[model samples]
Target: MPEKVNGIVADAIRRVRTSSGVPLAFAGVVTGPTTLRLQHFVGQHVGALSGLSVDVGHGLGGKVVALNRLLAVDDYLRTPQITHRYNTLIEREGLRAVMAAPVIVDRSPVAVIYGAMHTPTPIGGRMLDALASEARAVEQEIVAARARMEHAAEGENEMRDRMTAAFARLRDLAGTVDDARIAEELEAITRVLIAGEEPAEEPTVELTGREQDVLSLAALGYPNARIAETLGITVHTVKGYMKDAMRKLGASSRLEAVVTARRSGLLP
Candidate 1:
């Protein structure tokens, strides 16, 4: 599990370096409850920082993970805020400025992404924002990967594929309807097809028929562009529906929204 997470974080670190134009960037995935092992580095002059074990509340990455927030220092070696646990490694790599962004999943920190400069410079808002955005992207990927893993582990891939196809066909049929009432009824029945049995307790949240349509496709692991194409809507409109569905489901990510809807008997 840690290795899979490290792979995802490593790819994300490379992207961060490219997008943020940072001189140095590294990432680590959680190896244990209180520890994260540094696994991947990009733009580093030396390998001193590689494979370093970081503990919660110990250093920049640790603090970011502990607090579940982004943190940066102009001069990491001379900073009083974070512990100098990796001062020698930082010095070996000639790192001065550093920022750490927590990759959180389901409200828990799963990884940390670090960006650094070789000289003493403040980690600006733009760089911090870019790193944070990448972290969120990583979080989404991790969640979706986990969902795939769980689905495979449960040996339901075959059933899932059939359900996904059936749902898509039903949605296509629903689209052909001229009457609003008939279309809505079709959507309601599609929801039943998604969730095998009606939930005993009703969910407090309510999503419009269109919101459910978008979210149902999302549940099948369809990306927004594909969902838009299939539903004959603009990508921007697809995003709007997804955003509204996530808000209504109290979810922070697309996978989370899908999971919540399934649990709420809104999707299968």
Candidate 2:
């Protein structure tokens, strides 16, 4: 999970740098209830900021996490809103204009992404908007990853139950077998079934949390508008998620996507 989150944060900051032309882009994920560690970096010239830990309400990134909102400063060293605990580190990195957005999931901040410039050029609204959008995408991806993990756990339990039932059925059938050889074969099969042999691997299909959420609701015969209302998203966003899910599932329609998701253990 930590590696997956690092990948997501790396991709997000990379996109932020590419789209907004930020001279430096970096990110840190929440490692504990009060810890955020800078783990991913792009366009950085020095290692001063690498692996730096920011606690809640301590530094720029910390303030962002504490506030759960976007923050921008034309000169990070002189920003009154955030404490200057990382001044030496920021100075070594030569960062001036800095902005950060909280990657919030389920109303809690999970990570912080930042964009900065070498010169003290005021960060523009467009850049802030771009950062915010990427942060939202990160939030969605984290949610989806967590959902997939949960579904996988459930699938394990279901498999165990099915195996137990099959073993019982096999034992019952063995008792009725007239041929001694057949009975022995049945008993051997039952032993193999209960001996924890590796099951055949199934095809893997990945679905984002929002995509699964949209498909699961759609499976309940809800329209896009209703799904949006229920999930607190726009109808257009719901459709987009559904479309992406369908593409991943190789389904042409919502029903097919739902069916494929269930078969793939993406949906309950």
Q: Whose TM-score is greatest here?
A: 2
- The whole-model C-alpha lDDT of candidate 1 against the native structure comes to 0.86
For candidate 1, write residues 1-268 as lDDT tens digits: 6667888998999999988889888998887789988878888567887788998998899888889999999999999999988888889889999999999998999999999999998778889889999999999999999998997877785776567667766877888989999999887878778678676447879988778788878877788899998889999999999999999888999989887887787765
Candidate 2 residue lDDT tens string, 1-268: 7788888889999999998889889999999889999988899668889999998998889998888999999999887888999999999989989999999887888889999999888889899999999999998998899899899999986775465455545655676779999999987876575345432324377776567567756776789998788777899999999989999889999988876765654554
Q: How does each model score on TM-score?
A: 0.57, 0.70
Per-model C-alpha lDDT, please? Answer: 0.86, 0.83
* RMSD in Å for model 1: 15.4
State which candidate has the highest lDDT: 1
